[model samples]
Target chain A: MKRYFQNKSLLNLVFTFLGGVLLLFIIAPLAGMYLNTSFNSVHNAVGSEEVQASVWLSLWTSMAGTILFSFFAIPLAYLLARKNFPFKSLVNGIVDIPIIIPHSAAGIAVLGIITRDSFLGRAGELFGIKFVGNPAGIILAMAFVSIPFLINAARDGFAAVPERLEKIALTLDASPTRVFFTISLPLAWRSILSGFILMWARGMSEFGAVIIIAYNPKTAPVLIFERFTSYGLKYSVPVAVVFVTVCLIIFVTLRLIKKKN
Target chain B: MLVVDNISLKAGNFELKNINFRVDKGDYFVILGISGVGKSLLLESIAGLTKISSGEIILRGRKISDEKIQRRNISIVYQDADLFPHLTVFENIAYPLHSRKEKNIKEKVLTAAEQTGIADKLERIPETLSGGEYQRVALARSLASGNDIFLLDEPLSSLDSKSKNELRVLLRKLNRNGITIIHVTHDYEEAVSLANKIGIMEKGEIVHVASPEEIFKHPKSEFVAQFIGIKNFLRGELKALRESDLKEFSIDGIKIFSLTDAGDGEAFLLIQPDEISISNSVESGSARNHFKGKITDIARAKIGIEVTVDIGCELISLISIDAMNSLELKIGKEVWINFKASSCKIYN
Candidate 1:
């Protein structure tokens, strides 16, 4: 037993040392950017209406996108977890396609579906809504790429719940919908909630897809990129720092809620 | 009455083909089979959790194969209990009633909890309960639904022996109260102890359905014969004696007499262990089959001591503890085992 403990500690030390390098590597860039930016610049950036609008847009649109897509995505995830049919694996692979392909390509795919000449674009035009250079397009782009995270995580969550529970619920005179809402959904809430957070966070940080579909909407990430390329590190660092702070605050708050649940 | 008429289901590589069975009202029907033979699949299909490829399920003359699970009015209990982890025992029991929009959910939950002997534990969650208690909560939930028919899928297999026995008694009590039950299990003794009728399943197909006595006494196939190899089971040839109904049964060169009409060919003979009596001193009594053999082994049984006597070929006798003690039976003790000719069963 002592020998095993000694060996385990040695292996643990090696693991900690090796894994710590990547951890430090992640910390270095963010710490360097944060430390280089002045609090006065950050405060000034927060005061700017463009910064405020962009930040608010990023947060709310991402949340809206996460919530709206969840209704359909969650059911799809549950179906993936429970039932078996022909091309089921193909369907699963299609869900993951958004995650693996380039974000810009996903943006192009979204643009194709919602372009002004397309059916949804013309349909939205009748309702005084435009896809190009619009928040709706931004949400579509964000949701397109980030939905895989929600779907995969929720699918795993639903899978982790015992199938027998649903079977028993059905036998207990609960309809399929009732079993899903009462038994499956609650049991898989943790994973689904975490997936919600991840999807929202991933949507908030989106740049490539959002830029392609709606560059004028000026999400925080787009503004950061524009400022960085046009001005330099000094002008963009403050915005970057503020955006990171807001993301972290929301991420940590959601994490805490998940923990409590 | 519930009838599964020629139902067939294809689930991946396993298939339940041409499955047909029926359970009368107020009867405890058990499907006895080994694991991975589609026993649970059969129950799931019956519960409408899976779609059947062919045939129909009839419940009281109503075709229910097309009905939804919520409308089927049959409840089921699983082996692992599968209680909602977040809900208390009371809430778990009340959940089904709530879904059905039943009036007096609290009263029904309390009644079901009382029936399963979990009235006090209603406030507790399933995670805090033992295996037996967890299963009781599941059973209580089913009872709370007020369903007359129940499908239990190895509900006692996951429990300890004590819990298994307790659940068996509870099941019997529920059946006596006019509830029809179709239970699945791999344990032969459990089926015999609880089932008024038994269906033997093999490789996703039901091989035979009969009463427990008939199943044990007249196993139809080699698989069942091996699966339920009761004590003192032997395969041999039968020879007609000059006497009226007596036949000479020879098992591996050892001769025994039994009343049979298996005609004179090869046959199987079974002597129920409980039917044999053992004693230290030989008494010439009414029992036609008697042998003086040394007690080779004496072992504990579920209800008594199982003694194996090497009477040429070995023969097992089940005797009570008092009988074992009074007879002073032990290893290497000389004893006489006696059983009536009617006690022996012979079949081809």
Candidate 2:
């Protein structure tokens, strides 16, 4: 018992010492940025209409991407998790490609599909929808890079649901649609919600892809980049601090809601 | 009545070959087999949850092979209950009613819940319920559907003895209410107790289908005999008695008479342990076969003490604990084993 306690204490001490370094490494920079910036500067940055519009546009585009992509991603996640087909492993591997590849490459790939002269681009023209330099383009880029998170998480969620429940539901006279809606979807809702929040956060913080796709719409990250490049670090720090604080508040609130459920 | 007529299905690599059975209306039919014998797969195919590769399922004289599960009007309850975790007990029971858009959902749900003895658990979630209660909710849910046939896949396994007994009673009551049941399990005791007729499956094929007593007394094949755990599977030869129609069986020079109609030739003899009686001395028991053998072993069985006697061949007899003490049965004690001619089964 003495040896066991000694070993456990030593292991815990080493883990705590190592973990604190990484924790401090993350916190110190953010804390430094916040401490160096005066309250007046942050308040002024919040007051600016351009900053307000940029933050609002960022939230709007990310939320749009998260919701719209989820419709396609969720069912596909279910398929990925449940069905066995030819090249199933190949298809599963492809879902994570966006997460593995660089964001700029994903942006360019997405552009290839939506740009003028492409088949989808001309098809969109028939519907009077523009993709380039538009909020639509921003959503496309954001969703493209961040969709893997939703797909992976939702797949795990759907996989965790017992197939026997669905089978039993079907025998109880529930149609396939009713089973999907009432049984599979509700059981997988939590992981889907967590994935939703992660996708939104990742999409909003995206810069490289959004820059290549829709630089003019000026999402909060794009505005921060512009401020830094144009007026140096002094002008960008306050906006960065304020934007991060907003993201944290919203993310924490969403997490708490999920926990309650 | 439901008839699974020559259904052949290949689920992955495991194939059920030309499965055929008839479940009469209001009959409690049980398919007994070890795990992975495609019992659940067969049940799934009958419910239309699994599409048979080639075959027809006829129900009430109408072919339902091409019908979807929702239109089949069959309900199944699994071993672990599989209750919807997000839904309250009431909603879980009401699910089927909601699905088919029935107008009298609340009344049906309440009645079904009350019938399954889970009326007070209507407001609780599935996660909070005990294993027995969870199963009761699943039963209540299926009952609310008002289906003519219900499939139970090992509903009594993984339950405490008390819970198992309660579920068995509930299952008997369900069958009594005019619902045709096709239950699947590996437990022969459960099969014999609850099933009016039992089908024995091995390697995805129904080897035999008969009443529990018939299946136990006269197994059709060596596999069936062994699978049912028949202790005495002795090979013997039968010859006609000179004066009577009864046959005399000879096993290694030991003669035992039986009333089986199987022809006078090589045959297998099955003497159920419980059919054989034990006594300290010879008595006018009127048994056709009596052997004075030394007690080889005594083991505790679920029903009673299993006293193994070695005459020429070893034969086991199940006797009550009271009988065991009265007779002073112990290893190496001399005992007389007596079984009537009708009790011995002969299979060619």
Candidate 3:
């Protein structure tokens, strides 16, 4: 067994086998789909009204959700990291609720609040802003399920900042608020940015909640689902492939930026 | 002047009670204590880092109990070299000055860096600096802010002996320049060497507070005597008592005298390690009490060598290196160990 294992020939054979298997997992499906796909079909998919609207809606809603979630999550994360409060564990548990619940159930739960009968919908009606089938509902759905990643990640980031640094800042005559901005936030920013990127990617990929509340606006995920249902695999696969590749590029770039940070 | 009047704080498992002391303008008050004795907590309480349960911290004639830490004008240098890693060495030292938006911040930072000998590492980040350099930057950052009342919590703890001595000298210089320093450390020698007033803390309370001379010469309690490493403590009854301001006593047929004016009751004799002497013969000298004992052990200490001579009933005397050599001392050698009555303290 030692002689067999020590054989360099056997090691090369193992590498060849493993590399082929890995390449099959990563590259085979994309190659198979693209081989089957035609330039004319790609053009048609790109030109379609529903596909274009779906792509635009996905962009706007995810961007808006990411921005809003980051704005709210950063401070709350800092608070959870740095301060002592009553019912802290309870607050932490509550913050983790969205991440724990199934995405479909999370979507359903959000749908329950934004539907016409709910309090938020009632409040929105007073302001002449509807939620159901609206872009706002799509954004609300994306933000609801995806925000926990940002919050939790940002919390870890903020928690990593040594409290001594903050106290030192305070001793330096920086006010508490000033200290947070100058010392705490900057120190915790790498984690916060990673959280932000995770949230953005999660928001962009949101399907269940958007389908539940704003299926009419048709984010890319719902559109892909609808196209698959109506026109079978042949018609839908190319669009799905295009949508995924675009998102993959974006998500990877975001991750790289997070890594750099 | 910084006056901590009866500060008592109970945080988690650690309790600090009745911590009363004062540091006048330009005074370097070093608090010495063991781990978990609330030395850092006390410093924090004074700095407004930890909230005081009940106390008045009057700094520079201002009662800053409820005041925010930023407004208190008390800077702290923690043990961990708590420099902001994101900020460069210059930026870290410049932090306080920048926060106040003070004019001449760059000049102040440069000056501080120069003083701490970290001027060349200004542009370099904190993580790049060595432990000694990091602490020097921390100290520079602390001092550059213009807060004369500096709360240094083991600033030299991270540094080696050489660095510690250099920083100690720098701290002494700082004090001489009218910076009132409250330096907290677990090192007894540092407190003895650097502090104008040393507060010996045990179990959160300052058990003894005195000048270095007074504390070393006459520690009031057993804990202090033990803490300060005074090795000549023995349980004894005052056999015969002298009623003068400086009294006398005896133990176990070995007559001894103490400066403490205690009655003929239970007393513990206290003597510094340096005060005990060993002689080959009964030499007539300034020392009052002489006891015949066998040399038990010899060990080298920082200041001098300690000679432990066993006087049958477990009485020990710690003598100097010169004294040890002068007597040509070795283990199991019978000798006359003389520790004067005036030198020994009887604490009741």
Candidate 4:
């Protein structure tokens, strides 16, 4: 250790130390939340009605958002991976805009475009799908902010498929539609699943966006924030810890499935 | 019959221009070239994998140039096999036939797999198959499809020598069974052994088309000569000695004869490296042209040693290992090289 510190290449060592310090600093809050929990508080929170509602809403919305992501994002990802067209770069760049924007700004932008007065919002009114204070708005808000991860991951998976294999299928008289379903889609299914997991988790954890878009629906993140504001960290901590722990379990299970495949 | 009529295709930086050739039914036509000479591109264009920029692909006198690859009835095997990784070897061979809803799919797949000797490994995934095994699977897949036109893009390139030889025999057998094979390869020996008709491609153009024997004996141009492994060449003036009405010429300031009647100025002296014989002392024989030269180098060729003999400041003759041992030829040893006048061909 003394020799390592004395060496001139210790500059790299210094940077690595600083990075580890930063990682620990970032991880401290989550660690504290998990470590600070008492058995009584957890038991009480598990029995509470508001905590139950928040946990239920989180499960419902994340599942709905993931289903939406699979249907809407898979085709777009396939197109991005397999085809070259006009404005391809522009389209890909625009899809990733939500990933870089502030969550609050994304929520506001989504609200602006999706509120009752807007064209899409008015169109949705025909189908009785209201944005403000609704489960639909919660799902929409979560999906809007979390979709880029799914799209990009699935796109990479699809891109990794060799084009010749698809052509070989074509030569074998498999139609283009058949080829996509049989050859291209199966090869990229693992990436798409991982993307689905990411999108679901991100959507579940969304706080600022869900709060701005539809706070009344009270997904887990908003419930935690509301419980923190009205009843303090003592009241909200158990639910937050539970939600995170459940999400971790789901993430791990998805990862295991991915590995097996 | 497969007729590639005036087909031109551009793939990024390389372009196959005005490509015209015919592979008769049951012909093992090999496209021979160096890497990146657009041989693979040409085969792909013919297969409808790549769109032809111009011209018609006539198969059985039907213009199928604009047809989609699926409808073209062509099967292709790549160097890497490009087998569907998720599918088992059995499933992969069964894939094309199953997709077509062909009757007797299982029997076809098994027969093809048996022919390639990969029937036992049928249930294994592509990743589990070795290079040669994967290629055999690919070949089995193509054979199972029963497409008369087989586009092989150096399918045997990755195999070890023994497998390559075995596959060559298999390909020949397949060809004899009425598969019109357009084999693209960078290997000259593969081309020589396999091709009934060889098309030497250079810079995207089919420079020469001839039988294996004709190509080996008398290549048409410097490009064809070099591409076909003719390693001995000399730049010389074809001194047009106008004798009566008979116009004859000799190259390299050496008095030579020609069966190919010619009147020439500047020319390239071409000879098969194996045609020249080396001996310790010159003897009177059937060979007319003789030159005394010192051995410059000896390198191992497949069946024989390639001995390079330096004659004066000009000619270098490459002789065989058998000839070397018989004459006790070594580097710096003085030897007389002889070739029949018919062996020396002048290309201007």
Candidate 5:
């Protein structure tokens, strides 16, 4: 018993030592930013209209982009999970291209189709909207860079659902569409939701793509970069601290909801 | 009634060749084969879950080969009891009714649950149920669909013996209620007990289809004879034919009589192990065939002892352990082996 306890403690110590390094590496900078910032500076940053607009824009546009893209992405994910066809592997590789490339390259790729002379841009002009310097451009860039996370996660989720369950549902007089909605979708909802959360978070933090596409209506990351470049670390620290705290709260709340479900 | 007319399919590299069979209304038809013989694939093709390469499947005289699965009113139960884990037992059973927008669903679900003897497990999820209860839920779900035909893909394979017997009783009860069942199994005992008609499949082809009694009594092929536990097969040629379907055959120059009247030609003779009886004395009542043989070997069987005797040719005979002890049977001891002429089957 003594030897067993000694060995367990030694093993625990080894794991704890390695895990503590990664924990401290992540926590120390965030804690230091929050603790070192004064209340007055934080109040000033929070009260600023520009900062508030940028933060709100970041939150809602990412949420909008995530919700909008899920309609197409979830169905594609389901097809990837269940079907076999020619060029399936090619399509799967194309879905992951955005995740592998740099965000600036991804932004440039989106700009090609949505430029003023392009068909999509001309189509948008019919609705009195332009993509080059608009919120639509920012939304497009965010979705392009963040969609692969949702697709990959949701595909894995759908794959984990047993094929027999769907077959049984079909045998039970359920149409193909009905079987998908009633059996496959509900069972795979948890993973899809997680993917949604991941895409939303990644979209909010997008800097390289949003900056290249639409810099006028600044997102939180662009605003932080602007402040840091113009007024150095002292002025930018409060905005960064406030943004991190709010995102942390939102992420924790969403996780708690997921756990309850 | 269902008719699978020359239905053929290719799944991966395995091909199901021109399979033809018909299930009468309210018949317990079992397709008996070993695993990997495309039995499940055949069931899936009939249910429209998988596509057949050619030919048509007719149901109630309608060509349903092109019909969607939802339009084909056939329910299926798998061996693993693939119940929805996210739904309660009652909910799973009622899923078909809800999907069809049928009224009085709650009562129908409850009646099905009661029929499968799982009324008490209505609120439980599948993970919490035992194997038998899980299978009962699957059975209840299929039963509640109100389909006239039920495709059972070895529904009793995964259950314990006690549960298997209970499910067998339930299956018979369901059959008596006028449900046409197409059951697939590899167990000969299950095929013999539950099936009125049995089709033997080998290598993705239906080798023979016959009544269970005929399959056991007179297997038409060497594969069927060996598969159904007929241990003794002998090569012979018919010498003469007598009245009342009696025929004489020679095996290794020894004459034997059989009840099947075949033409004078080479034939295969099959004798079931249990049909041959052993006695210490030569006296017999009505056994037409008898031989003085020596006990060559003895081994323990499930219900009795299996004694091997060399009556000019090797023959296996099953006798009760009580009989074994009384006869004091031992190796190299001379004994009498007797069986009726009707017990020997001939296939050419």
Candidate 6:
């Protein structure tokens, strides 16, 4: 080991040092946030009914949004990967628009379609559900802001699969639909699942969009903001710590499962 | 039986024009061409993977040009195998069965695996298999579909020589089991070994189609002759017509005889390297044509030595290394090259 490093040039040492600094820059803030909070505050925050409800709302609504949106997003991804049509690049650019634009602007875009006067809002009213200040509105806002991750990731996954494999499947008497579901989808599942986790996490942490669309049924991010404004950092820091800890545990477990498979 | 009738297709900037062919049932038809010559495109168009601009593909007496790929009951194996990475070998082979909703899936999959000698690796995935094993699994998958027509696009090109030989035997075995095959390959040896009928494609056109023996021995075009490794192409004009369908031609004032009944006009003559024999002495028997030339070049061929003799024009001959040693053949050495009249093929 000593000889290995001794053979390195000074330029290599400088590059290594810069990369180490970037790694530390990412880890330091999260480590500081977790270490500064006391265990008693984290425990008390977890036990609070309103905090528990907000965490539950964030978890289920984001999961619901990801699951519901995947049906459409995955097929669109397959089409983008396999087909050649007019305005294809425009459609691809439109998929990325949600990711690049501000979350507040995304929220307003969802608002225009779901407002009471619009046809979609009237349709929701016919189903006895109001979008303004409701869980439905929150789910819609979460899905709107986070769906591009799923689409782009799944599209890349499908693109990586060999076109000949799908053609071979079709020649083997499998229909195009069967070929997609059996061959393309299963091969691309790893990317699709990672996309699912990313979209779900992004929805869980969404603040500006959820605040604009629905504020009554407070998600974890909205509740944390409300606590910071109403009380001091003393009240908000515990909730933030609790939410971050839970997210860390869940994300690590998911990544471990992904690795095992 | 299958027929590709007057097929014309435009793919990007490449255009295949008026391609026509027929493959009888149980025939191992090989399309031989160099790369970028629309061989794979032709196979894909036949399997309905690529659309043809104007054509009718007939299979078993029915026109199938407009049919969907799934309804065509044709199976193709690509060069890379293209096996599904997510599935185990068993699942990959059994995939078509699931699509067909067939009964006895286990029995069918096992039969195909056993036939391809891959039954032991059924539980493994494609990523873990060797190149030969991956191709065997792909072949098993195609065979499991119970399709009669098998289209292979350079399937053995990626394997090592030992593996390629093994798969070649396996493909021959599959052909013996009553499967009509349309194989596309750039390797002349593969085409000669597997094909009963060979089609030579050049620049997106089927330039010549004939039996393997006829193609190698009597190429009708200069391209076919050169592509098949026939090194001696002498452009000559017909000078006389002898009895028993024999004709004489002269090239650069040197006369040659060919056993063809072609008319008295401009003609091209082709002679394969193996058809010529080299002798140290000028004593020749039944061979009708003989020329004394000095050895100009000698190179190591795949099987033996390739000797180029200059008899006004360069003529190549393949002789065994032992023969070379016995004759003590060397550069600037004078030797006699003898060939029969039937050996020289003439085309007008």
Scored by lDDT, the top model is 6
Off by over 4 Å in 6: A1-11, B231-277, B280-348
**DockQ for each of the predicted structures, in order?**
0.54, 0.59, 0.59, 0.55, 0.54, 0.63
For model 5, name the residue pairs that clash. none
lDDT for each residue of candidate 6 in B1-348, tens digit (9 for 90 to 100): 999999999998677889999999899999999999999999999999899999899999999999998888888888885898889999999999999999999999999999999999999999999999999999999999999899999998999989988898899899999999999999977876678899999999998898776787678888887677857766669856645567788988788877775557876677888999999887558788899999999999879999999999888999999999999999999999999889987654
The CA lDDT of each predicted structure is: 0.89, 0.89, 0.82, 0.82, 0.89, 0.90
Scanning candidate 3 chain B in windows of ten residues, the lowest lDDT window is B239-248
- Candidate 6 CAPRI assessment class: medium
* Model 3, position A3: C-alpha lDDT score: 89
Task: Please tell me what DockQ candidate 2 reaches.
Answer: 0.59
On residues B176-289, what C-alpha lDDT tens digit does candidate 3 reach at each position?
Answer: 877889999988767765777889899989988887657765788878876778565565677554354545555666667665544567656667656776778886877777
Q: Compute the DockQ of candidate 6.
A: 0.63
Question: How well is each residue in A1-261 modelled by candidate 2, as lDDT tens digits?
Answer: 999999999999999999999999999999999999999999999999989988988899999999999999999999998899899989889998988988888888888999999998898889987888889899999999899999999999999998888888888888888899999999898999989999999999999888898888799999999999999999998889889999999999998889887
TM-score of 5: 0.80
Q: What is the total number of backbone clashes in candidate 2?
A: 0
Please give the clash total of every predicted structure, in order: 0, 0, 0, 0, 0, 0
Quote the B-chain TM-score, candidate 5.
0.72
iRMS value of model 2?
1.1
CAPRI-wise, candidate 2 is: medium
The per-residue C-alpha lDDT of model 3 at residue B333 equals 95
Question: Which runs of model 2 end up more than 4 angstroms from their true locations?
Answer: A1-9, A112-130, B10-15, B230-277, B280-348
Global lDDT of model 6: 0.90
User: How good is the docking of model 4, by CAPRI class?
Assistant: medium
**CA RMSD per model (angstroms):** 10.3, 9.8, 10.7, 10.6, 9.8, 9.8
Residues A1-261 of candidate 1: C-alpha lDDT, one tens digit per residue: 999999999999999999999999999999999988889999999999999999999998899999999999999999999989899999999999988999999899899989878999999999998888999899889999899999999999999999878877887878888899999999999999989999999998999999999888799999999999999989999999999999989888888877887
> Which candidate has the top score in DockQ?
6
